[model samples]
Target: MPRIELRTEIKAIKEVVFDLSRSIDLHKISTEHTNETAIAGTTSGLIGMNESVTWRAKHFGIYQNLTSKITEFDRPNYFSDEMVSGAFSEFKHEHHFEDSNDGTLMIDLFDYKSPLGVLGKLADKIFLEKYMTDLLTERNRIVKEYAESDKWKQVLTK
Candidate 1:
């Protein structure tokens, strides 16, 4: 498995950041480049513990569907989602948030294993890791943007 860890500092309340992190709407917006959409299961709002979402998206020029469930969640603190079915053999993402002197500290721990065994490992070493890291970075950037501004209201207030 490959793991990617990221930390983002946002000037916002932990509650707001936590909610924004779980908002499906915000996820769609952040991944617009990949045309990501939640086709079923909590498609539009915050996804909580035991909730699942099936997402369809274009990745590497191909459209793929992935279903993942929130296995663990603690409001305003942390949450972890794991893949139920997807292209990858394994996928687990943990989102953690903490109150900081300036604002909130958001941390992401992404772990994944690709299919095809050896070939997958090679791909991960060659490019998959960087690609996934970039994707997470962009997602966190969007989260930071929303958390720091009133834009979060658009997705969180409803």
Candidate 2:
């Protein structure tokens, strides 16, 4: 299993960051062309403690459905989701938020193991890990932009 952790400083409050991060609709908006829909559980709303959801999304043009359950939730601080069913053997994502003097300090911890033992590790070392990291970085940028934009707030509010 490969555990990836990324930290970023966000110029926002904990609540704002948490709200934006927990917003599945906002994620859909940020991802833009992602053909993903919430199929079950607390998919569209703010994910709370023990909430779970299944998502059907097109990844690299291939349609896939993954089910993830919220194993831990502590608003404005930390939350975690564990894969119930998906392509990987096991997957868990933990999001941590801390309020700093300047802004919010966010940390994303992703741990996943592939079904293909040695080959999976090789693939990850070669490209998958970096690709995933890049994806998360881009996603964070989108989130930061949206969260900081008044226009985005207006759109969501309306």
Candidate 3:
């Protein structure tokens, strides 16, 4: 399994950061590599503790329907989601938010493993590791950008 951790400071409300992190629609806004569509449960609204949802997404040129369960959730503080069923052998992600002097400090922790046992290791060494990391990095960058913008400010006000 590969674990990826990223942290960023954003000039935004903690609630906003937390909310955006759990928003299915915002997931779409944050990445181009993954085309995600919400298929079940509430998709466009705020998600709270213990919420579960299903999404169909295309990744690595393969379409997979993933069902996620919210394992941990604390409003404006932290939340975690784990894949119940999906393409990967294991998938889990945690998002944390803290009140900072400037605004919010956000941290993302991702852990996942490829499907094939030995073959996955080889694939990871060749390109999958870097590719996946880069994709997550881009997702964080885009989310951070969006969260710090006036558009997100408007979203919070609504």
Candidate 4:
């Protein structure tokens, strides 16, 4: 398993950032490059504890489907989503938020185990880890963008 942790500072309240993080609509916007779309279950709006969403996206030149469910949630503070079925052997993503002088400190802890055993380890060392990191970083950038401005209303108001 590989763990990737990231911290991002945003000039927005934790509540706003939290909502944006779980917003299904915001997720689609952040992953437009991958043509990621919520194909079933909690397809739009904020995803709450126990809710699952199936996403269809193009990755590595192939289309894939992954379903993940919100396993834990604490409003404006922490939450976690674990993969129900996906390409990876298993994966869990934890989101944490804390108030800061500037606004909010957002943290992401992503842990995943790729399939194929040894080959998966090699993939992580070579590029998969970085690829996943980049994807999460971009998503956070978009979250910050929305939270720091009035744009957040567009996603949360619905």
Per-residue lDDT over 1-158 for candidate 4, one digit per residue giving the tens place of the 0 to 100 score:
79999999999989999999999999999999999999999999999999999999999999999999999999989999999998999999999999999999999999999999999999999999999999999999999999999999999997
Q: After superposition, how far is residue 12 of candidate 1 from its true place, in Å?
A: 0.4
Best by lDDT: 4
> For residues 10-115, what per-residue lDDT tens digits would candidate 3 score against the true structure?
8888887787777666666765457777788657666667777888878778888988889998887989999888777888998889999998988888888888
Model 2 residue 41 distance off true place after TM-score fit, in angstroms: 2.1
Instruction: List the global CA lDDT of all models.
Output: 0.96, 0.79, 0.79, 0.97
Pairs in clash, predicted candidate 1: none
Answer with 3 or 4, whichever has the higher lDDT.
4
Cα lDDT, model 1, residue 107: 96
Pairs with backbone N, CA or C atoms under 3 Å apart (clashes), candidate 2: none
Q: Quick one: ranking by TM-score, best first?
A: 4, 1, 2, 3
TM-scores for the candidates: 0.99, 0.89, 0.87, 0.99
lDDT of 1 by residue, 31-79 (tens): 9999999998989989999999999999999999999999999998999
Which parts of model 3 are misplaced by more than 4 Å? 153-158
Better of 1 and 4 by lDDT: 4
